[model samples]
Target: MPKYPAREPLVLLPCRLPASLVARFAERAREQGVTLSDVLRAHLTVDEAKPLGKAVPRKRAGLAKVSGADPKLLRQLVGMGNNLNQIAKLANIASKTAQPMAMVELLITLKGIEKSLEKLSES
Candidate 1:
């Protein structure tokens, strides 16, 4: 099986179309070396996939314009409040790992955190 970047799962979206047009659209997508989803996304409002060059400036300006800003850099700011809570839990686990039971617990905690980080980073 081919591997792809770990991304958000595919969401089923409903659309109205004649059967013939839908079949033709699918065929055209195959000929163009892309999936039907790719064709749909190209013509749809794909906000998340906007070019980073455009996104970065817009996000930065929007964030900076807030009266209370600057505690964190732009990249750090998105979804950051949740990140801090996760980091604190990790540190607490590490600090309590001197004894054997504590060490095992810490290992489990660390593993769970690793998986969570992998999911978030992929996003």
Candidate 2:
């Protein structure tokens, strides 16, 4: 049996399909060097057509103009950002290799936020 990602589950979603149709997709999967599951997941989008995977990075929006922004409010925003960063760092260290799925999701979310902050700082 092939091994999947350690963080992912071995989900078996069974459904009826004609043998010929399954063979067709299997052939395509072989030619494409990807699993039949990947092909089907990408092809089907009835529920919601969310993109399958990571998005192409976009150029940062650049910081919003703050020429007339309140000074105290701006300082508070910066402080909040610093606090969030510290929390993320602590979470990273506290969640070990065998962390639960929920913790992994939290880390992913924190990582995304960190990336957003990084792009914001670029401007």
Give lDDT tens digits, candidate 2, residues 1-123: 244579986678899989999999899899899989877766665666675697789876433453566666577568768878786776776675556775767678778777877775786
List ranges where model 2 is wrong by over 4 Å.
Answer: 1-10, 47-123
Candidate 1: lDDT of 18?
92
Per-residue lDDT for 81 in model 2?
81
Predicted model with the maximum TM-score: 2
What are the per-residue Cα lDDT tens digits for candidate 1 across 1-123?
234468957689987979897788799799899988777666565565566554443335455577456645555545554665775676677677645666566567667767766786787
- The deviation in Å at residue 122 for candidate 1 is 63
The per-model lDDT (C-alpha) reads 0.67, 0.73
Q: Largest lDDT belongs to which candidate?
A: 2
* Model 2 residue pairs with clashes: none
RMSD of each: 14.2, 15.0
